[model samples]
Target: MIDQAKQLREKMLQKSSKKPSRQTRVIAVTSGKGGVGKSNFALNFALSLTEQKKKVLIFDVDLGFANIDVLLGRSPEESIATLLDKDLSIWDIIEEGPKGLQFISGGTGFDEMFRLDETKMNKFFHEMSQLQGSVDYIILDTGAGLSYENMRFILAADDVILVTTPEPTSITDAYSVVKMVQAKDPNVHMALVVNQCTSDNEARATAENFKHVTAKFLNKEIGLLGSIPHDAIVPSAVKRQVPFVLAYPNSQAAHAMKKLAHGYLKLPVPYKLGLKGFLLKILFK
Candidate 1:
């Protein structure tokens, strides 16, 4: 599987130069804390984009708990760690998941990625630059909270999808993420996703209150992306190691994801800086 993926990547790269290039949207999907179903949402969201005939890649940069491969029931033989430890390029490490979604696993020892030497740093940036126009979107599944690593991912992205629940602590922590990011880069664009809601009214109220507070206190306006209802099918799909959108397409959560994807496409996109720009910000800032 790994060899086949690498070959496919080569073909794509070969044809890329012949085609007019467009900026690939880099979206970092994160949360203020864990247990809010952030990674699950990122996976399903990418799959939903693919359903719209857009090519997408999900990079698992969660450092501590990267599990995109586990969620797909397949183990990647190579990962970002491989690019550092071995003589492999970035394309050699990308693995394909279900529904033709591509992803890069954050293997164990991924923390070392932030401490690269000068030579490795250049090589890493140069390899990643090749992905500038290779896909329509690159969704980063970053770790939750306000860690330094997570902040780097958030600041470098074109937009952020902040995932949170209706719980008070979750709301508070989510605000912290926004506050910290604003402190560093006030120009960063962000949106909200209220997951695990019990009803539509609860979701609307949660999103409204959160947006209102950000506007009043932080003086920032966070867009409302969409919400996912608390459905048993999500957990069941997780247990089966299948994306809920595929395993239970008719379920409430699946229907919500499809709607979310459609709404996201219709929204006006903020200016993007592409993969090379993303690498520069992440490595320097």
Candidate 2:
């Protein structure tokens, strides 16, 4: 059994490493508002994907708040701020996370970097372009909102995973993001994950309602990326400064996150994004 598992691991690694492309698969995980557990989802989701042998990188681009490093019990000295100001390579700011997961911290205290002009954006993109060929996926965890920054990242990503809770306001705000994505880039692949639900039925009902409203009002079709239950283990894991997926691997949220990671891989990858194209998408008009 041990030998078979080892072989399977080797096989997955070989397949993941062989995924050559013009650009990495960029997926931005965002939300309409905060306090929806977006940060936790992003960190665990990336790590879970890594478990499947996918080379994963998290670009923590949240302007107002940054939580990934804190959640992992590590602090990064440098962040995207360094890239915006200094002549730093993408590699210079990347901090290593658990199990080879590479991440770039957000602009925590540097408010100026958040309001970047075209010149600053161009330079930032130029630096980010250097990471074009390095990984299988580049996941952006943007700040929760319909802010200009969030929208830019949302549209730029090849896939947008919008996180929301089961609350009415949360669902309403999430649909607002969907409307914006549709207006900006109707063709952008969009998915919704109902977080902090208590049961599968609740999650599904919320997802269905959101999908129905979006299809009816906005005429947009959004994929349901599955739901994460309101697991007690989540808060415990958070307090311990570890991912729930790692701390309680068999817990409800952990299982849900793993399944979500698997669903992410099943997404269709028709082509990869080139460096220039990637920058253009992020720096959209």
Candidate 3:
């Protein structure tokens, strides 16, 4: 019986090895504190990527205060809880958002995710694995702070996008979050996105201040991805349940988000579907 069990394990390992791996650009959008427009950034960033014709999946992992669905003006028929109940698959829970983007809403109740057991963990991983080959990017909209569940998702992602505003409290909290994460994972790739800045110079200064502090204290390098200016059009669009990028493409915030998308994702200016088409043809075979 021991020999038979060993043989079965070997076969399982071989089968798993043969399963093709999908190239997914997983990005976690996290902030040090709440009310810094983290969800807004996540929603707009996914939309910007979808405009480039990339298949993006935005996962609303903000357990306590889930708002991605509200931001998209969507009421999903199913959610992560539905999937956990085995009544729906990952694909079944995905709701189509603006610009053809897909999203998975977080659980509606205020249940702590850290209570998940090994069996539930396995099930969740299997559900996420189903996203393989179907999505080009998976944006994890994590809750603010360094909760155990939040850090777990942040560490699992390929990159972490730290969101912050010009407020003193926001900046300080942002630094604290980064410091905590670095203590756990020294080589984690981090990118900074400054939001609610008054002007280009203000954004640059805020990012520089963060870079300076991190380098001096933690001896770590934080890449400044880009910034979004404080534009009234964003809140106005939100009130109407529309993403600013789609609602007011000519707005300053919209244009800045597009530029930030191009810079962060390393896509060419005037980002178009042609870039993704070219990449898929050359790299996805």
- Candidate whose lDDT is highest: 1
Candidate 2 lDDT over 1-285, as tens digits, reads 335434534543455456545357788899987899999999999999999987788988887787788889988777888767766656667776788788888765545654578888878877777666667788888888888878877776777789999999888888888888888777877889999998899999998999899999998887789889999999899999998889999998999999988987887845545445656766655
Clash pairs, candidate 1, are none
Ranking by lDDT: 1, 2, 3
Off by over 4 Å in 1: 1-6, 14-19
> Per-residue lDDT for 4-113 in model 1, tens only?
76786776676555554657889999999898999889999999999997778899999989988878888888887778788887778887778778888878888786
Give residue 73's error in model 2 in angstroms.
Answer: 1.3
Cα deviation of 74 in candidate 2 (Å)?
1.4
Candidate 3 local accuracy as lDDT?
Answer: 0.76
- Candidates' TM-scores? 0.96, 0.87, 0.84
Q: By TM-score, rank the candidates, best first.
A: 1, 2, 3
Q: Note the residue pairs that clash in candidate 2.
A: none
Better of 2 and 3 by TM-score: 2
